[model samples]
Target: MRSLLYSSLLALCGALWARAFAQAAATQKRSVPPGFVTTNGRNFELDGKPFAFVGANAYWLPLLNTERDVDYTMQQIQASGAKVVRTWAFNAINETELPSATETGLTYYQVWNSSDWVVNDGPQGLQRLDYVVSSAEKHGLKLIVTFGNNWAAYGGIELYINWIYGAENATHDIFFTDPAIIASYQRYIKTIVERYKESSAVFAWELVNEARCTGDILSAGPNCVPGSNTLKTWYSQQSDFVRSLDANHMITAGGEGQFFSAHPAEYWFDGSLVSDYNFNGQAGEDFAGDLELPNLDFAGYHMYPQTWYPELDFPGSNFSVEEWGLGWISDHASAAAKANKPLIIEEFGVTGLQNKTDIYPSWVQHALDTGHARVMPWQFGVLGLTEDGGNRAIKYSDQIFRGASPNDGKTHSTLTRHKYGISSQRLRVFKANALDSH
Candidate 1:
C-alpha cells in the first residue's frame, strides 16, 4: 500500500539474520540453518554482526489461491531487496459466515464451527502458512508473522468478541482484558509458535497488528478504556507466554507507537504544541513503555501524516507531509535510543504518488542516520493483484511501484503439488549471505 525508494544498504546488509524453519508439507524439515537474529542494545545482530535491513508488508502472501500465486509474489518481493516480510498468520469466521476466499480453497488459520472455534491445520489451514514460511526460507527471507489483527479484514478482534459473546459489533479493547478472550488468543498463538518453534525462517512473533484502544467495527465498549493500564499488563503477560514457547526468536507488541498520557495537550511533536489523541495515548500506544517490557525484544511505530494528522497537509499550515513525517520518526528514534532497544517503522506511507516520491527517500535516510533497526513500508505491491475482492481502500497507492508480472501458474489439487518449484526456491542467497565474509 505504501512505497519507499529502494535501499541498496538494506539489501547489502539485511540478510544476515538467521533462525527459524519450515514444514514444506505436513511436517517436513527445511534447509535453513538454526541461528537466531538477536538484539544488542539498539541493533539486530546475527552472529554478532549488525543486521539492520529493509522489509515490506505483504499480508496476502499466505492467503493466495495457489502455488503460482506464491511464486510470483515471492519473486517480486525478493527482487525488491526486502529480506523481511511481515504478514498475517490469522483468519476467522463463524460456521455460517464464509469469506469468498474460502470458496476458492484459499487458507484460513482458524474457523468457528457451530459449537466453537477450531484451527484448520489440515491442507485447508496452517499448511498454507507452512508453505509461506518454507518459501521465505528457500528465498532467503525472514518472516515476522503476526498472530491476529485489530481490524477485521481476516477475522480480527471483532470476530473473536462476536464468536464469544454471540453478538455483533463488540469493541476490541476488551480483547486486552477479558479472560476468555485472552485464553482463546493464547491458544491460537501457541499453536503457531510450537509449529515453527525450531524453524530458522521466522524472525519474530508479532503479538498483533496495530493494536489500539479503538477499532473500526465498533466504538470503545464500557470495559475498554483508552489510555488506561489495559495494554501494558496484557503485553507483559502475553509476551511472557510467547517467550515460554520459543525463547530464541524475538517477540514484539505490534503497536503504532502511541504513548499514554494524562494531559493530551502536554505532548509535542518537533517543538510544536498539538493535543492530538494519537500522541496523547488516547489511542493506547506506549512506545517507551513497550520498549521497557521485560519480554519484548524491540519497539515499533507507524506513520501516515496525510491521514493520522491531516492538518499538516492543509494549504495554510505551510507544513509538508514529509517534514512532519521526519519529525514523527525522529521522536520514536530518540525514544528507542533512550530505552536501548531497536525501533522499526513497521508501517508508513503517504497517499499520493508525487508526495511519496518526494518523501520516502528522506525517511529511509533518516532511519539510517538515527540508528533505527528497520523500515518496512505499508506494503509490497504486486502487479494485477486484487485484495479483499478489490474493495480494500487504496490507502497508500503512492510512489510508482514495480512488481513482477501477473500470476500465470495453474492451480493444483493437493498441498504437495505446489510445495516445491523453481520460483519457490529462488531465494536471493547471495544477498542473504552478503556479510558472511566478515
Candidate 2:
C-alpha cells in the first residue's frame, strides 16, 4: 500500500511540473510586444513584433486609389508581405484631388480635383472630409500620407527648382508660411484627426514631400523670392500644429534627399520622426562624405541606380542588377547602421528594364537582406481609377523617368510569396521547408 501511494504522488508532481513549464512558455511569449516597436530582445518591432516589411508603395490618394486599383494592388502588396502603404495627402497644384469634408460616406478625406486647394468652398470644394478615413478602414491597409509638395500647383519643389535654375523654367511657390495657408492647413489636420481618432489604419503622418534645393528656396534668385525663411517657419509651424491636434500617430517629413540634413532632425522634428534621402548617403551630392545622421528613426533611400549612374544600361540607364542592388543596399545599410535606426527604402521600382518583372523580386530581396530597410514602391494610381495605376512606382514609366528603356506594352501580375521571404501568416520564410510556426 505504501508503494502504491508513493507512485501516485510522483505522478501528481510530474503533472504539475509539466503544467508550470507550459505556463512559463506562455508568459515569455506574452512578454514580447507586437508591431514595429517592441520592449525586449531585438529592441524594436514591426506591427508589434520583431518584423520586416515585404511590400510596395501606395502613392497619391488612399481613398480613390483603394477603390480603384488598391483592391488588386493590395492582393499583390499583401502577397508580398507589406502591411503599410505610403501616399500624399494633397497635390501641390490644388487641381481637384482633395475629397469632400464628409465625402465617401465615411470619416476620412477622399480625393477631389487636384485644384481644390486653390479655390476655397467651390461647389465640389465646400464638402467636408470623411470618405478618406472610411475608405482606408475598409481597405485593410495603413497609410503614410504627406501633406506638402511642389507638384501640380501647391508648389514647394517647383518653386525651389525655378529659383535654383531660372524663373522661365521654374515652377510657382506654394509657400507654407502664408497665414491663411497655415490656417487652412490647421483646419485640414483638425478634421482628419477628429474623424479618425479611433481608426487604426493610419501608419504615420508625413509633413512635406522632398524639399529640394533649400539654397534656391532660401535665395533671392528669380523664382527664389524671399520666403525661404517663411517657408521654413511655416514647415516648422505646421509640424507642431499637427502634433498639437493629434498625439496618437507618428509624424515625419516627406523630405526628399538632402532635406533630412538641410534641417537637423533633432531641432526641427520630435525624436520620433522619420526623414528620407535619395541615392546618396552624404550631405548634398557628395556620396563619399560621412554618413552619420543624428536622431532619425529610420534611414530612407530611393534606389534609382539608373538616375545617378546613367552610364549603365538597365532600367533607368544600363547597369548590372547585381551591381546596382548591391551598391544601393551597401549605401543604405551603412547609413542605417550609423544612425542606429531601422531603414526604409521610401521608394524604388523598375522603370524601363527589359526584365523588370523578373528582376523586381531579386532586388527587393537584396534590399531586405542588405539594406535592412522597410520599403514602399511608388503610386497606387493617379490617372482616373479609384485604384493604383500610374508611372509613379508600381506602374509604367513616363517621359520624365522612362530612362532609355521602356515598357513593351505588357501588363502582368506574377507575385510570389517566396521572393519576399513571406507566407500567408505574414511571417518571413527563411528556407523553403523551414516555417516559423509562431
Candidate 3:
C-alpha cells in the first residue's frame, strides 16, 4: 500500500497486528486511577465517559528528523481536533532495511549489527518516542503506538526474520514461530509497556502494523500456512504474552480486516458469488477471530479499494470504488458488533481530492453510523516542500486535500486545478473529527 497511492498522496500509513503487552502479569500502578483507556465492550470509556474519536495517522511523529518536527506535527494534529494519533513505535535500521522517505534519520529505536540486535532506549532512540507520547499528552490527545509491521516499510517482522535468517532465506511467517524471535519481540514490548504503562496518553499498543503469512521481499516458507488457525495460535500466544506485562492499557491486532469465510456470499458485504482468497482464509487475516483473542481489547481494519481489488475500480464494474468501500466498512462493523469489541478503521483514503470529496463523506458517515468505533484516515500531511523547493502540494490527501490519478500514473501537473488554500486544513480537519459534512 506504500508504493503508488502513498507516494502520490504523501506517504505515511500505519499497520497493527496481533501482538503486545504479554504475560497477564501486568499490574496496575500503585495508587493511580487507571492511566489507561478502558473499553466498554463495543465502545471506549475515558474517565468513566463514552470515548469515541476521529484519530489521525501521523506515522512519522516518532521518526521525524528532529524534535522540532515532533512538536510541530503534534500541534497541527491537535489543532485538527484529532483525539488520537497512530505512529510507529518500532524503528529498526539495518544495512538491508527499506524505509519510507520520512523514516530516515537517527531516530530509530533499535539497531542490528551483523551478529545481534541492540534496543536503544537512549536519547537518540526511544526517547524520541517518549517525546511523542509526552507531546500528545501536552496536546490533550491519545496515542496508538504500533510495535512492528508486516510490510517491510520500517523495521518490520521481516527485519527480525532478516536478522534470524538471511534476507534471501528469511521467511516472513517465521516471526510467529521462532523462539528467539518471539522472545526478542516480547523483550522490546516489555521495555515499551513498562515505560508507558502508567501514562494515560497511550491509547493502545499494536503488536505489528499488519501481520500475515507473508512478507514484503520474502514470502513465507513451508511451515507458514495461509489459514486462520496458524495465525490464530500465534496471535493468541502474543496477546496473552502482552497481558502478562501491563493489564491496564488496551491492545489490538492492527490488521487489514480480511475474513476467513470460505463462502463469499455468506458475508453481506462481500458482493462475491465465488470465493476470493482475500476473503476466503488464504490471506492470513481473520477479523472476527482476532477480536476473540482474550487480551485483545479491540479490532482494526485498513481499507484500500484500488490497491487490493482493482477490478471493481475498473470500467464495467458492479459499483463505484466508494460503494465498494462502504460495503467493506459495513462488513467490518458487523464483525466487530458480532464480537462485541470496539473497532477502529485505522487506515483508509482515496486519491484525487475530488474523489475524496465525493467519497469520504458517505464512508465516514457509514462507519460512524454502523458502530461505536473511530475513523482515522491514512494520514495527516504537511505543506511540505516539493523536490524543487516550491510550496504547492498540487493535491494532497489527509485533511487538507487536492487531486491526481495515482492509479493512472498522472503527474501533479496533469491534475485539474483545485484551488489550494490554508483554510482547507482546519476546515477539513474539523470535518474529519466532527460529524460535519464538508
Candidate 4:
C-alpha cells in the first residue's frame, strides 16, 4: 500500500509540472507588448509618447547581413541617435513561371520568388527577419517593413506577373490587374502580417518600394507608364488588405513624390520639364491622390534632386540645389498638411561622387524646420568608411549572402563611402538637426 501511494504522488507531481510548463510556453508566445506606434493628427505617437525620428536605410538588414553584423549595425545606429530603420521584409525566389522554346515545355525561375515565403526556424527564410525584429526591439529601434519591390532586384512585382502569366506575357502592369497574381500577393502578405502581428517593433508597412510600372520585359523602356488609376486602385486594395490583418501598424504608398495632373497635355511642361523618369512628368505615380486614400496612414516621398534634375537648363534649374530640395519638401508638406497627415522623406541621399556634401546638412535642417516627421537617408551599413576608419566590414556569411553577390557591384570611392556611412560629419549634421518636435 505504501509503495502504491508513493508512485501515485510522483505521477501527480509530474502531471502538474507538465501542465505548468505548457501554460508558461503559451503565455510566452502571447507576451509581446500590446502597445504600438500610431499617428495623431499629423504626428506619430509611441506608447502614448510623441515620436519623431532621424533614421537610415538598411534595406538588406534582415536578408543579407549576419546576426553579429545586425547587432553591430543596430548598436551603431542607436549610437548615432537614429531612432528608426527601414529594411525589406519580403524577398521572392523561384516563383516565376517561364515558357520553354518547345510548345510542350514549361520552366520555372526559382530565384526572387518570395511567394514561397515560410516563417521556418533557421538562419534562412523568415527566421532572419525574426532576428531583426527581436534585435531592433532589444536595441530600442522602430522598423518600417516594406512588403514588395517595384524593381527587379529581388524578384519583385515582375516575379509575380511572370508566375501568374508566363514570362512570355509578363508585364509589370499585370501585377495590379491580374486576379491570380493579386491573390498570391495577398497570401504572402497574410503570412507575414499574421507572423508579426503581435510585435510592436514594426512602425509601418510600405505597400511597395517606389511602386511604378516601367513596362513589360519585351517592351521595356522609360516610355512605358502605367495609368495612375490602376496604381491607386492597387494601393487601396493592398492597404485595405493589410489593415484587415494587422490594425496596429500604419500604411504608406511608397511613391517617389510624383504629382499627378489630369490635364497632362495642357499642364505637362509648365511647372517642371517632362522626362521619362521625372515624377512630375510622365512618371505614373500620383503622389497626392495616392496619399488621399482613406487607409493610408501618412504621406511619404523620396528626393534625389541631383539625379532627378541633372540638366542645368531644366525649368527648375533656376533654383539652387538647396532651393530645389526645399521646394520638393514644401510641395509634399503642402499636400500632407491639406490631408492633415504626417510626412516622411523615407529615402534621400547626395552621392559623394556628385561632390554634393554641402546639400546634406541643408536638406536635414530644412526638413526639420518644415515639421517632417522623419528623414531617413538611402542607407546605413558596416561596409562604408567612418571618420577614423575604425569600423570594419561585417561579414555576411549566409548562403543567400554568397549567392546574391552583394560585392559584385562596382566599389564606391572612399568619398562616397564617407557620404553613405555614419561618418562624424554626417552624424553631426543628423544629430544637430534631429529635433524633438512634439
- Which one wins on lDDT? 1
lDDT of 4 by residue, 1-438 (tens): 111111222222222322222222111111114557776666666665556666667776764335665676677667656677888877655523222211211111133334343333344557778888999999988888888888766557777776566677455667777788889788878877887878788888888898766642533333335444677888899999999897778888887877765444221345674543443435567777787797898888998766665654245446366677887888787777777677888887655433343565556556655666466767553443221233222223212222221232221222134334535555344333332211
Instruction: Predict model 1's lDDT versus the native.
Output: 0.67
Q: Which ten residues in a row have the lowest lDDT in candidate 3?
A: 15-24
A best-first ranking of the candidates according to their TM-score comes to 1, 3, 4, 2
After superposition, the stretches of candidate 1 with alpha carbons farther than 4 Å from their true spots are 1-4, 7-33, 99-101, 166-170, 222-227, 261-274, 384-438
TM-score of each: 0.78, 0.54, 0.78, 0.72
lDDT of each: 0.67, 0.40, 0.65, 0.61
lDDT of 1 by residue, 162-222 (tens): 7665455556777888788889899999999999978878889999998877788666766
lDDT of 2 by residue, 325-404 (tens): 66556665655454445556676655432344345445545554453535555432212232122323322232111211
Candidate 1 vs candidate 3, lDDT winner? 1
Stretches of candidate 2 above 4 Å error? 1-47, 60-80, 92-132, 153-194, 214-241, 258-296, 308-322, 357-359, 371-373, 379-438
Q: What TM-score does structure 4 among the candidates reach?
A: 0.72
Per-residue lDDT tens digits of candidate 3, residues 84-184?
88988887776444243223334667778774678877776888788888888888889998888888766777777777765676677778888888888
